[model samples]
Target: MTRRLSLFGATGSVGQSTLDLVRRDREAWRVGVLTANCDVQELARLAIEFRPDVAVVADESCYGYLKAALAGQGIECAAGAAALVEAAERRADLVMAAIVGTAGLAPTMTALAAGHDVALANKEALVSAGELMTAAARASGATILPVDSEHNAIFQCLAGGRIDQVRRIILTASGGPFRTMSAADMAAVTPAQAVAHPNWSMGAKISVDSATMMNKGLELIEAHHLFPVGLDRIEILVHPQSVIHSLVEYIDCSTLAQLGSPDMRIPIASALAWPQRMATPCAPLDLAAISRLDFEAPDEERFPATALCRAAIAAGGARPAQLNAANEVAVAAFLAGRISFPAIVDTVRRVVDAAEPAAPSSLQDIFSVDTASRAAALRFVEQYEHA
Candidate 1:
């Protein structure tokens, strides 16, 4: 029987990669639902291509355009967050939680609560509500699969091994666009320059996160939640090649690594077929052609995003949500030319440092921290703009 799937963020990089794989096996897969935030054209195109039972656009303003685009196509049309949540609980065997930021939390949790297996590509969802998410997964008996390359690698390596026998998991970083830039040079980098990742093509926000190593920091927090391990057990290594995705060190002093070309499809396909490997569209790694491998420690002094991420994870509760919100606001300001590129980390640090950690007892608690954090970040931007 073909497994039914619901894809959220159906227009983003991860969503597109997932659709590519699903389209290849249309005979063995059924596209139950597809959703996009505001990309009416793309959503309409996907609706035609996948022929899902329902198509949802999160932005209410784009509903008419999307609805008209799918007129007479016999597919159900819905709008806004309610539509997304409704899609989350529909007849989907698997849910791809690929929406970019913290905004993905609600619908993702909705899917988990409804007992659908989740292929999670959005690290912010896990970062923001790891405890709540995992608890819901446990209560509902739903599986939470990791779609990030680093976490996916660790998940693959941990197969058939006892968790207690694991020593450490080392997550590899591309060192992003600023690996070699001096601190003075980094301070003047424009948004375009920062998003220009040398090794991989990704969305702009994620690209900027990579440049500042905040992506790695968020992954660090994600690792803490995904694996039953302490923060000290997770190490970040700068591998400019992007060949070795991640490594798992065993208690017996052996290290196992997952290597591949810089392609998101490899990890996405792996998550889609857990306990069974499938053909990935990603190019095979050529060890003979690539003769060298390099590694370095992330500089906490220059790229303070790493330190800020660590502090947020250590603080726990709503701190991670606050960190994510502050970073998002700060990055947006930087991208809009309202702040220097380097000030992204500074703004996040100041906001998180000034904010008090709150115990998030419910989803509202998480949103409360998120709102206050954004406010703090905006206030920081205003002060900096006037300074």
Candidate 2:
């Protein structure tokens, strides 16, 4: 039977990649809904092409444009966060939660509560509310398939093997644009330069996160929850080549690594067809052409985001939520030219350090932590007053 799919964040990098896979086998799957943050024109175009049952624009102001565009297309149109959450919980067998940042949490929780198998591409959801989401998944009998390349690689390598025999889950990073830059040079880095990642083409927020190596840090929090592994068992290695997605080490000294070209579609395809492999149009890996693979330890002094993330994970509870929120605010400030690239981590560090620590027992608690962290982050930016 064809799976009915609802894709949140339809215009984003992850959402668009999911669309590419679904579009290839249109007859094999049905598009139940497509939701976007704004991009009404692009969302309308997708609605026209896919003819989904529903089209949602997360920005309420863009609802009229979307409604008018889909007037004759027989697609239902709605807007705002409420509509986005409703779309997620609507009649769909599978939900792709791709909305970036904390905005994705509510809708993703809704999807889980509605008992839909989630192809989770939003790392923030897991990082911010790991305990709550995992509990929801257990209670609702919902399955969460990891869509991030690193998590997906580790998932594939494990094959649901005995966790007790696992030694460590080692995640590989491409180290972004400033991997080799000195601490002083990173302070002068421009937003344009930071967003220009060497390996992956992503949205600005994630691109900036990549530049700071905080993407790996966020992934570490994600790994801790997704794999239920301790902080000691998760390791991050800087592999600038981006060939080895991730690795799983067994207690028997055996290591399994997943290799591929830097393509989101591969992981997307893996999530879409779990326990069964399908042919994706991702570029084939040419190991023969590239004979050598290099790996190095990430420099904590140069990129402090990774260190801050590790500390957050060690702190537990709402710490990850604070870390994620603070990082997002700092990255946005840097992107807006209000702060230097190096200040991104500094701002996050200050915010996380100053916040009142809370042991988050529920989803609401995580949201509370996130809000406080963002506010604290803004305060740090104000105090620094970087032009």
Candidate 3:
């Protein structure tokens, strides 16, 4: 059976990884659509090769470039936000919601509203709008498969187990490149050092998030939404090996875990061929060859982003959006060398503290708060620059 598929953020790391898998087995999927934020060249290249039914670039200014690149190729080319949402509305068996940040939220919602099963890679879509997203999925009868490694690991472990018998879920982290660095060392670290992830290769924004342990914080929120678990029941363990993806505890006090090499394709392949297995060209995990796995507690003093996020989770409503929005702004500032690395979390704290978060009545409400929070966080960045 050929499954119809659409990919949002076709030029991103996850999207590229996904393409690598799908392109190998072209007969298995009908490429319904492919969309990229602004990379017209890459978008056109993928379109020419894979030949999706439709191609969209979020940067409307590049529409002419993309269209000219795909001329006479029999693929429809579109540009701008409306086209992205309209593409999501196209009929498909599954949609890959991999558009990185909050920009993915609307198209993800559109896919769910259209009742397509979504393989979600956008952490912000769940972190900032979990309640709304889950509610919409419930109403639309759409399934959301977690593509993040931790959540995907827990998902596999929880299979054949009842939710009631589950005790807690422990998510492991590589702790980025600063697990052992002192507070003073982190304060003086540059963007180059912060983005040097020890285990994972990711985009700059996500790499920065990992350095501050904010990615783990964001993933904690995502897990809470994905699983029927309380915020306090979720724990983060710093496992530098990145071998054990995640663990789930049952009533018997035994823990079940999913182990794999640090490869994104493993989980993504699992999501795409769910309820069935697919062969991926990834190396098998060899436990004996890899000496031993070390585990320890994440230092809250050095990485307080998680602690701050815990507060926002407890606060509920629009606070998570505020926290995520602020962090994105602060990360951009740090990446641009306008602020110190420590100022990333500090700026997030200041903005989250000042926001008067309230219950979001609609998706637009979430957007309003997100916009306001971004402005507030930028002000913090300016403060740090002038200080």
Give per-residue CA lDDT, model 1, range 1-387, as digits (tens). 688999999999999999999888888689999999999999999999999999999999999999899999999999999889988999778899999888899999999999999999999989989999999999999999899999998888888377788899999998999998899999889999998999988888899999999999999999989997788898899899999999988999888898888899999998887757778667888888998999998877877887787888888889999999998898889889999988889899898879686689998899889899999999999988999
Consecutive 10-residue window with the lowest summed lDDT within model 1: 273-282
Best by lDDT: 3
The TM-score ranking, best first, is: 3, 1, 2
Tens digits of per-residue lDDT, candidate 3, 129-216, equal 9999998899999999999999999999999488788898999999999999999888899999988899888888999999999999
**Every candidate's lDDT:** 0.90, 0.90, 0.92
Error (Å) of candidate 1 at residue 162 is 1.3
lDDT, candidate 1, at 137:
96
RMSD in Å for candidate 2, one decimal? Answer: 1.2
Q: What TM-score does each of the candidates earn?
A: 0.98, 0.98, 0.99
Tens-digit lDDT track of model 2 for 281-361: 889999999898999998887877888888888888888899899988999999898888888888888888786567988
In model 3, the number of clashes is: 0
Would you give me the overall lDDT of model 2? 0.90
